[model samples]
Target: MTRPRIVIGNWKMNPLTPAAATTLATAVAREAGRVVRVGVAPPALFIPVVAEVLRETRVGIYAQDVSAEEKGAFTGQIAATMLTSYVNGTLVGHSEARRYLGDDDERVAKKLIQVLRAGLEAVLCIGEREDEFDAGATEDVLAAQLGAPLHALSESDRDGRMTERFVIAYEPVWAIGTGRPATGEHATAATKTIRRVLEEDGGIDGDAIPILYGGSVTASGAIEFAKAEGIDGALVGGASLKAEEFAGIVRAFA
Candidate 1:
């Protein structure tokens, strides 16, 4: 079966105003036809405005992150329950969260549990750092990053239903925001490695999962990644801030 196509924009702290947020959301919604699955994760504060604009559209709304702790005393953390009423899914274990916010694999595992329990989909980010990549251990690094979180799940959470809501994004730390994206071949190789780890180690039907390539993805570069056999779509960053560029990527995958 063909993996479903999707384009998810991670609008990390931009537009700088509610008016701009809704305007951008409306533009994206206008171009996001009913064909491919399209979603965006805006800053938490902007979610309400963006959601209001996208409510009747086919485009979906998502949260940038959710707290690993379900509730209470984790000051400044947004719980999954708090987001259940707003987003259809949440981005988990993003590299920025891992690098700056201290979300190691264990914490990522906990966040995954929370997102799943709240009945929201998760787009889990996994990749090797520049140093790890330089060591020629991309596959090993990818496996460990992905496996540790998955293995931490209970037997029941590892079942098919859990797999249904999970999406993996392979975004090399070295590639993201560097204006240099991974080649289609490199991304395809990484996707297969992720699939193998999910199936052989995690005991999940890996092929059923949609693995995306996310790294400084732009309209022109998106074509190569979209055409790659195992790459389902993208988790866009910078270029996603612009409606035309983002819609171009959606068209690439479509």
Candidate 2:
């Protein structure tokens, strides 16, 4: 089967109020159903308001992050199980979480397991930093970052079909939020490395998993990135906050 095209808006810490989030979600719901799959991740606190607006639409609700720990006294952590009631899926190992929250590969692996077991799709984010790219170690960095999580996959989870729930978003840290998205050539190459590791190292069907290009994606460049070799869709950030602009991107991909 061919990989399905998808676009997910990560409204990370934006709008600053529940009323704003509800309005954004309502706007997004209006633009839904044109794309194969469209999702939005509001801040954890605003998930309910967004979910209420998107209730019957084709658009899905996602969590910006999830806890590696199942449950306990982990202050400020939202367990995967807890999110199952509110969201269809969750973003794991995002660049922000890695850089600011200190979610390394091991923790990411555990969180991936938690998400899967909780019956939620997991968007596994992996990429290299600017320094790593400057050092010509992009491929190596990508492979290493993916290693722990893939190895953490159970034998049953590697059965091809089950692996479909896992999507990869290659967001080069330097490119994110910098207005300098990776070129089509650069993204294609990076995704190639990601696919190689998924198939060769993880013993899974790489083509079955959708790999997305994230970081500073905008309407003007959406189609180019969407049509790039090996890219299935986008994991949008800043540009997603605006309804019209985000709709333009969805139309581009559609």
Candidate 3:
């Protein structure tokens, strides 16, 4: 199968204003092309501005997170269906949301279902914490996370048939923002495990899926991670706030 070169800038909660976010998004869109696919998930409030700015460009506008509800009385939750006009995709289940917001696999799975239900794509993050890794339960942890949330999908999606609207991010919680990135081998291995679980448990074609590396992905580290075997691209953090630096990461595969 052909490798998917996709780099996503997950801006998280940064950049003081929508105009500032627009500036960064425009800069990244300047580098988009046919080589590698690039997208950005600015804060929810900024998606509209960013989406409009990058409309003619290859860069896609994404939401940092979306609600599982289609439409509901759930206050403060942005439903996936509600975001169709704003973004092309979303980054669901990032470690921060799992940790600080108490979103477990079941909740993430529901969120993923909501995303796909709305005809949007998703970058699902999964990884072991530092303790789980140290305890040699990496694969075990992954299996649980990947397996649980997937139950929310119909058999087709679980079998990996939804390649276009989905991506898996192998984000080791320990690596994110710690300034300690995973080595090429480590990232590749984690993605291999991700692919294996999908292939074995879901009958998905390994090559048909794109597994990305996330965490403290710097411009320098982007080179190896982008080209590393089994690692399709990245879900960038702080560095995504910098226009030139984030564009360089996009060019790592481009």
Candidate 4:
């Protein structure tokens, strides 16, 4: 049987202190054995510390973002190798990074390569803007954003590098951190599209690929998504900062 895959939370930019981190870590650890997989992505600064706490516990630690470049004069950038050396893995091409940090598809594609080269899994995020959704271009936008990068990979990159080697996260831009979530139907449809694209262009075996839903995934909201076909897990935002909330969300699979 295929086991459920659920990522508990992504504590983006909150919980700046050690005390706060410890509290959340303790909560996830308390209920770690309930799910197939549980992970937390804290701010880059605390990745090492959080990773230490999650070690030997049920939760895995991750960095929220990483640079496409392995090393160089890109001031203020954290390279994939550095993140892999410190944390278990890192998130790439998140909506915030695409919106604020000017990460285009080309850059994200490079980052995906970097993450894999460094021996860490890449949570490659793809999503549509609210305007695109309003214009009924959600599918088009998602295809371009999610499929283009991997499709652009060279033959070697596709066969040896990315084929079934990364996690795809579908996060609707409007839902992220806005306290609103894409309806279960919407998320399910989008994820299905993502899987089809991967199979068609990237040669990623559908059964081996894991597609995670992001954007405002809550304990109550997660149940419906957990039951959706093709939804392997979630890339949670706000709720991951609190241990209890994240644990509850994980329990949805149980």
lDDT of 1 by residue, 1-254 (tens): 67789899999988799999999999999899666799999999999999999999999898989999989999899999999898999999999999999999999999998998888999999999888888999999999988888888888777678777899988899997675557999999999999999988888888899998888899999999988979999999988899999999999999
Candidate 4, residue 7: lDDT: 77
The digit string of per-residue lDDT tens for model 2 on 46-164 reads: 99888888888899899999999999999999999999889999999999999999999999999998998888999999989989988999999999999888898888766655575
Please give the RMSD to the true structure for each candidate, in Å. Answer: 1.0, 1.2, 1.5, 1.9
- By lDDT, the better pick of 2 and 3 is 2
* lDDT winner, 2 or 4: 2
Q: Clashes in model 1: which pairs? A: none
**Residue 97 accuracy (lDDT) in model 3:** 94
Top-down lDDT ranking:
1, 2, 3, 4
Q: Cα miss at 26, model 4 (Å)?
A: 2.2
Best by TM-score: 1
What TM-scores do the predictions have?
0.97, 0.96, 0.95, 0.92
Best by lDDT: 1
Candidate 4, residue 41: Cα displacement in angstroms equals 0.6
Could you give candidate 4's per-residue lDDT for residues 70-165 as a string of tens digits? 899999988887876667677889998999989999899888888877878778899998888889998888888877677766676666445435
Backbone steric clashes in candidate 4, count: 0
lDDT of 2 at 139: 95
